[model samples]
Target: MREQFPLQQEVTFELARDVGIRHPQVSGSFQVMSSNFLVNSFDPALPKFVLQAKYAKDLSDPRTVEKLELEQRYWEHKNVPWFLVTEKEISRTASQNIE
Candidate 1:
């Protein structure tokens, strides 16, 4: 996620893979999909992050939150703004495709 358009309905992997494909030297044949639920515009200013708790429920867990917070603090201490994206959504999607 980067600089989200709050006006858009979805910010999807289709968009990212399209971007990846547009670059001559980049890998273009990536699989892309969208969350079946929310696509938020969080804060409108900081668009680099997209919160998908509803799409993958466990993200809202207290333990997961604590772990994410701890990891975030650790990264921030070292001046890194990294992401911890969900794998379940993609995994479930792949499984669905197989079915």
Candidate 2:
């Protein structure tokens, strides 16, 4: 039988500490089920990935863009796939079901 590993959600990483920095303001918040989904894999060969969700209109904001870039960089440093998910990508039925 194959060993099963459950997917993890809302994973947060301490970037400053990992990179040998002690900056108080430098932190990473990967919140899932609302704005982002940080999926982790127990298998060493499998890479972890992130799914960030945002409204179509919100994507145009400068702050949002900056946040997205930071997230992309964080994932890239770890060699993980980062995906953007907009409201248009989510089905109404599925959203309702989740709610």
Candidate 3:
């Protein structure tokens, strides 16, 4: 399951679906909160990856850290991974420069 901002919801969902399809035995869903995807793999005892999307600029922001902490606690409660997907700084800066 996957969900980013309203603008990237579809794109992120597609990505999550692609990942899910690669693992036929896995089953999970996109959460409404911090986690974009919650995957439950075949190994029940292993820690699952908790995918989240964020912008490059937000990476060093205090709010981003807070959100990460919250996501960690939330996913950890259920024993999940705190994987984050952030835009590449170089690419983002290049794009900004182009503009």
Candidate 4:
């Protein structure tokens, strides 16, 4: 059976306090699609995704980098996929569609 999970935006977690992150831009879970038995064998609640959005210019800041690293480690420890999205990487077409 398939279940739907709502996308959470601008969410803060308790771990954010420890990691010095004010909040993450987006986070959610989705079903994993795989034909391999091992890939699909995990508990249903385990897979999740995190997205942190920043301006391209902010990526060079030391504080930003440090906070991002801490956030990455927090997600890594929990075995979730974490991604950093900068303005440069965003496509105008995608943004329009999302709107």
lDDT of candidate 3 over 1-99, digit per residue (tens): 454422233443444454442211225754433466665567767545666767768878765565465555555555556677666534767768868
Q: For model 2, what is the error of residue 4's alpha carbon versus the real structure, in angstroms, after optimal superposition?
A: 24
Q: Note the clash tally of each candidate.
A: 0, 0, 2, 0
Cα displacement (Å) at residue 59, model 2? 0.6
lDDT tens digits, residue span 18-69, model 4 = 6665543426553221111112225667455666767889988986776567
Model 3, residue 63: C-alpha shift (Å): 1.6
Structural RMSD, model 1: 13.6
Candidate 1 per-residue lDDT, tens place, 54-95, comes to 335777776555434543443344343445555554577686
Ranking of models by lDDT: 2, 4, 3, 1
User: What root-mean-square deviation over C-alphas does model 2 reach?
Assistant: 8.4
Q: What is the lDDT of residue 56 in candidate 2?
A: 93
Candidate 2 pairs with clashing backbones: none
What TM-score goes with each of the models?
0.32, 0.57, 0.47, 0.50
For each candidate, what is the lDDT?
Answer: 0.39, 0.57, 0.53, 0.54
Model 2: lowest-lDDT 10 consecutive positions: 1-10
Tell me how candidate 1 scores on lDDT: 0.39
- In Å, residue 27's CA in model 4 sits off its true spot by 28
Q: Which candidate number has the best TM-score?
A: 2
**Clash pairs, model 1 backbone:** none
